[model samples]
Structure formats: structure tokens, C-alpha cells
Target: MKVLSGIHEPTKGTITINNINYNKLDHKLAAQLGIGIIYQELSVIDELTVLENLYIGRHLTKKICGVNIIDWREMRVRAAMMLLRVGLKVDLDEKVANLSISHKQMLEIAKTLMLDAKVIIMDEPTSSLTNKEVDYLLSSISDHESVA
Candidate 1:
């Protein structure tokens, strides 16, 4: 999972996806190739709003006059839809720190779903969650599978 996600580059062997060879890769390429990982250790930033966190590292933008300007409206709409798909409703402007752990987890799932990844690896995602949270999380993942 790590190698496919491009967290590491194989030293002695090459990887092929769709007949493409890759000896060295990075996370950017992973996303480009429709691969992503959701670590057991969630990477939700506490200081950022739910909206901000959802778009972290994957901000949508347009270049105008050689300046990259973020497309806030489009991102907001997509973030809301992703959260809804996960059955997690959150105040888009709410800070992540103020949310419950479950909400944070849901937010993380929403973030990954928004990435349009073909495959996602979840690492012990239920360890810190409650039974109800786990149930919801699993159901959400199942729902994502149906959509995908």
C-alpha cells in the first residue's frame, strides 16, 4: 500500500500499473494515477476549518494573469457534497479542533473521497473510534464503493 501510494520508491524493483513502469514515485503521482492511502494516523489539521481541511494539499485553483487563484466556490460545493456522501454533516466553516473525533474521521474520509482516487488504503481507521462511529465509517466506505 505504501509503495503504491508513492510514500517510497522501490530501490531494486519496478512497479507497473496498466503496463506503465515506475521505479520511483511520489504522492502527487499516486493521486494522478488514482491511488491514495488513509493512514491509521489521520492527518486532520485542527486549526483549519472543515472546509479548509477538506481541501488541504488538493486545493482547486485557476491561473489568471500568471497568478494562481483558488476557486473557493467550487471547492466549497464539492466539500459539502463529499461530506454528505459520507453521511457526515458539518459546519463547513467550523474549526476541525472543535469537532468530535468521529467527525474528524468522517472529514478525513470525505477528503479522500473528494480526491477521485480509484483505490484507497485504510490503515486501522477504526482503532480510535467508538462502535457507532465504526459502524458509520464502514457504512460510509461501503457507500463509497457503490458510487465508485
Candidate 2:
């Protein structure tokens, strides 16, 4: 998975996606190719709000008087939609530290979806989830597959 996601290079074989073969790939290129990964460890920032985490590095921005301003409203709307798709409903202003393990896992999934990844590789996604949460996660993934 690390090789495929471009976090590490393969020493043996080449990787082909969409009929394009890559002998060398970087993280940015992999993401541009619509590949996303969710590691077993949660990556959420405890200090950030849900909305902030969702758009951490890629915030929507608008120019005002030649100044680039973060568009909070647009980020909120898109974050809400992505969270809904992952069956996670929480206050956008809520800090991630206050969320449960399952909620944090769902937030990670939502963050991956926000990247518009066509292929998402999750590592032990259900390891921390309860039986019911696992069922719901599986169902949500199935629903997304059907839509795609």
C-alpha cells in the first residue's frame, strides 16, 4: 500500500493506473492520480476543528482586494456533505480531541473522500470500530461502490 500510494518506491515492478505506467511516482502525483490511503493510525489533529481538519492543506479561497481569504462557508458545506456520505454527523466546530475513536475513524474516511480519490486503500479500518460501527462502515462503503 505504501508503494502504491507513492510513499515508498517499488524496487521490483512498475505501477500502472489508467493505462499509464509509472517507474517513479511521488505523493503529489499519486494524489493527482486519484489514489488515497487511510493508515491504521488515526491522522486527525486533536487541536483542529472538524471543518478545519477536512480542509487543512487545501482550503477553498477567494480573492478580496487582492488578498486570498479562506472561504469558511464553502468549506463547511463541502465538509458537511463528505461527512454525511461517511455517516458521520458532528458539529463542524467540534474539536477532534472530544470525538470517540469510531467518530475519529469516520472523520479520517471523510477526509479521504474530500480528496476525490477514485481508489481508497484503508488499512485495518475496522480495527477500532465496534460491531455496529463495522456494519455501518461496510454498508457505507458498499453504497459508495454502487454509486461509483
Q: Which candidate has the top score in TM-score?
A: 2
Instruction: Name the 10 consecutive residues with the lowest summed lDDT in model 2.
Output: 139-148
Cα-based lDDT at residue 94, candidate 1? 96
| TM-score against native, each model | 0.81, 0.89
Task: Name the regions of candidate 1 deviating beyond 4 angstroms.
Answer: 61-69, 143-148
What digit string (tens of lDDT, one per residue) describes model 1 on residues 24-96? Answer: 7788888898876777777999999999998877789988899999999998888888787777877999999
State the lDDT at 3 in candidate 1. 82
Q: Kindly state the number of residue pairs that clash in model 2.
A: 0
> After superposition, which runs of candidate 2 have C-alpha atoms over 4 Å from their true positions?
65-67, 145-148
lDDT of each: 0.80, 0.85
- Collision pairs in model 2: none
